[model samples]
Target chain A: MTNRSFEQVSALLDDAIADTREQAQQLDTLLSDNEAQQVWARYALYGRVLKGEAAAQAPADISAMVAARIRQEAPPSQVVQGRFGKHRMARWLRPAGSVAIAASVALVAVLTVQQSQPVAPEQSVEPAFATNPLGGRSPVSYNTVLQQNAPSEAERAQQLRLLQSYMLDHSQQLQLSLQAQQLNEQSEAAAPQKDDN
Target chain B: MNNLKQQHHKKMITNAWRSSITGLLLLCGFLSSSAISQPFQVTDSNQNQAVALYDEMARALRELNFEATLVRSSGTRLEPMTWLHGVYPDGTEVELIVMLNGPDMRILRIGDDTSYYEPHDEAYTIHSDVTFGLLPAAFYKNFSELQPHYQVVGGRGVRVSGRNTHFLRILSRDNDRYHYGLWIDVESKMLLKMQMMTPQGDILEQLQVTTFVERENVPIGMSDVRGIPRPPRLYEVRNLRPPQFNLQPQWLPAGFELLRAGHRRVADSGLPVDYYLFSDGLTEVSIYVGSQQQQGLPSLAMQGRESIVNSTQQNLAVTAVGKVPVTTLQRMVDSMRAVEPNATQP
Candidate 1:
């Protein structure tokens, strides 16, 4: 892209970041006050972020801080299972633990740079491979660990079935009310000589 | 050069004199023909003579003793109604009896009050206006005023009920109202037959006299036919109250006036329906406003002599009714709106 196009893209990204921060702040306030509103807002925000909009990714430091918070507040198995599902929990946990290991290696590079030594060529590729896994088995092994440590399958299945039944019953009651209303209208039309002249 | 100038001035004077003389001669010839033809053409004289004739006709209508059968033809249906009218010599007694078949209907009018008798309903007194149907009393009260709005043309003379009649056409000046043609008796000027025509020249309704009698010797009791029970009052009607409109329209077609206004209870929701009526000397229209639901929009349906047009806004329905064209009805419906306090002329 031309320099001008690059600048335009950067400005758009800046706007997107500002808008996301405002919405996040609003969601935080709503979460403390209105439970229903907060749940709906979080679902809407998740839909926006998953739509492949490049502007959804935060700055590197902010992402790391958020990840740290998740680690501190939630058990690793719960975080892995929530994002990747119970079936895929084992696959996500293995790569996530490796990322923590890569983070420690990046700390050593920072210390070497400050000592005024040129980094070795082997160390140059270390950050890339550590941050992201390349092999397919890596994801599978990671998920297996998360699934074993998370909730049991039978408990999750029972809760899902209850929610489905409740929704079906509510819809059936609405259909019955509509049928009764139509019957009343038909009877009124049949009795024409009641009052009108 | 002097001779040429003198010749040109003489030629100009001669041409002017010749043209003026020709103009004067033409004017004289035209005036003479108009004077001679004045007696031949109907409605050539001032309205004073027509007004006098109208007064005489009204007096004859009030004083004449006659029993005639009138056949009212509308569309493909023909209805025959027998009418009996008489006036006492003392000018105090008057009676009119009209009887209809099929449904077995009879209307008896004594002075101002009228009583209707029907097979399924008991006899009861009704307002004089109801007895007239859609006929305005202004036709009988001051028909001379209509002369200005209608052309009085002559039609083929005919004989009705052994009385000599001359046809008098009352063509309307505009298509805004219906036209009428009446056959009046030459001697008494009493209307013998009348036909009402639409704008397209189609006859909507016609009342023709099959038979009529001019009675010089009639019994006094004929003017006082009694013992007829009045029809039961099936409908209790009060004058519709006028609505307090926040805005009144600044422009309306000429010859229209507010007739009545009031609220009616809608059958479905029992909500109050606002209604208003306006009339020119001839045509009448009723407008209605009410809260709109899915069914509250004005729907149109035609039954015999009546046609209704309805329209709805966000929450208001407006309906206009008359014998007017559908376009006119739609225009009236669209013009109605809730008046705002600060409405200004555009």
Candidate 2:
């Protein structure tokens, strides 16, 4: 209806409006008019020429190239905030989802493989052997050279003292184990249903 | 006439097929229902029987006078030992444990005084009602003491030491600690074999009896041990008090309670350490929180049923050791958080 329609269509193409949805709809309505469409096409060509994007010699298949590009693109009217936002979200999530799945698969594979393999043998401490304490000599000789032996003799003695404490600590655990058994039984009786059942 | 006969035969075959299918479906329904009901009936009785058997085993160990030869195996090493238990006419209990391999080590307990005699170490005595042996600790303790942490379950009967034996497996409720399986002689109620397994079902240690003989008189060797001299003074554990630690564990397996807490000096480093002991009845773990001087020790190591997880937090080193699965120990150490002085509940 007014020359302002051509200027508004141009502004919509350049994304110059803050409210893009209203401007896009206005441009769609204007394009329906043949006269407005012709003016829009002429303005686009003129802008491209001014920007030096137009070819010096027109390409022979330029029309075919433009048609193919238009076919590849989504319809401008359909690509609004909601649909395009979802498309962008899906693109962003694809790699993150793939990485998470890959990590879980690797973890499962590793656990299954570990379960199938035989357990490795534990390292053996020095076996308690017969020694004459009355001889006034350190009779308990270790077969494996312990790391503590690397330090001075005082360190080795300290290590033995530490071993003594460890043994004492372990011996005390026997009492706790007995207590645990009783507690477990009481809990089991109070709740007749067990986990395995 | 032939056509009519063929039709009758076809009708009979179809009826037979339909009835058979219906019967099959009925059978499946009945089977599924019974299977669903079986656990309640079976497990209830099994629980009662297992509890009774555990009580019987404890009574057998206390009242019965028997001498048994046992072999304890851990990793590649094997240690054979002889266990002796007797009750005198004056109502005194005497038990002796003799190590038959590599060591001239022996344990002698008369009433409440249990003494340990090992090579190159002074014979020290500790006041205890039960003597330590290769069998599980569950055998010597009362059911009340152990019922809170481990579930006692009856397992299939098996032959052990050439005797008919019934199994009572002590399963940890949380599945984070070690599990123990014991085979008791059906007739005598004596423990025939004991096996300690990791959470993943790997055998870490086993003690199996080779010979069990009831003695009418006290063995001559045990009588000779009764005369050992003793002083009134004993090596006392000085840290008999509660813990003074800022760090408290935030996570623990089910039924695990704090048994002992104190501060003890490290014999190797002379660094003071806050110690806490936790137990789920059948398994125990010790946690030590000290200065960062202990960081040079192994971060993680597992041997037999015992594992160690050493970690540091906020310039403090936390080490946990016990006969538990590695993951269990790791969780205990990782859950430790430094608490504000007023917020500390333990």
- Best lDDT goes to which candidate? 2
Tens-digit lDDT track of model 2 for B65-127? 777778877655577777777777776788777666654566667876665554433344545
| Fnat of all models, as shown | 0.00, 0.01
Question: After aligning candidate 2 to the native by TM-score, how far in Å is the CA of B98 from where it should be?
Answer: 0.8
For candidate 1, the per-residue lDDT at B96 reads: 46
Instruction: Report RMSD for candidate 1.
Output: 42.3
The C-alpha stretches of model 1 lying farther than 4 A from their native spots are A1-197, B1-43, B46-55, B127-131, B144-156, B160-163, B217-224, B227-251, B266-271, B294-304, B313-315, B325-327, B340-346
Runs off by more than 4 Å, candidate 2: A1-197, B1-42, B231-245, B267-269, B341-346
Per-residue lDDT tens digits for candidate 1, residues B261-297, read 5565432233455656565645556665655552332
Cα lDDT computed for each candidate against the true fold: 0.46, 0.59
Candidate 1 CAPRI classification by DockQ: incorrect
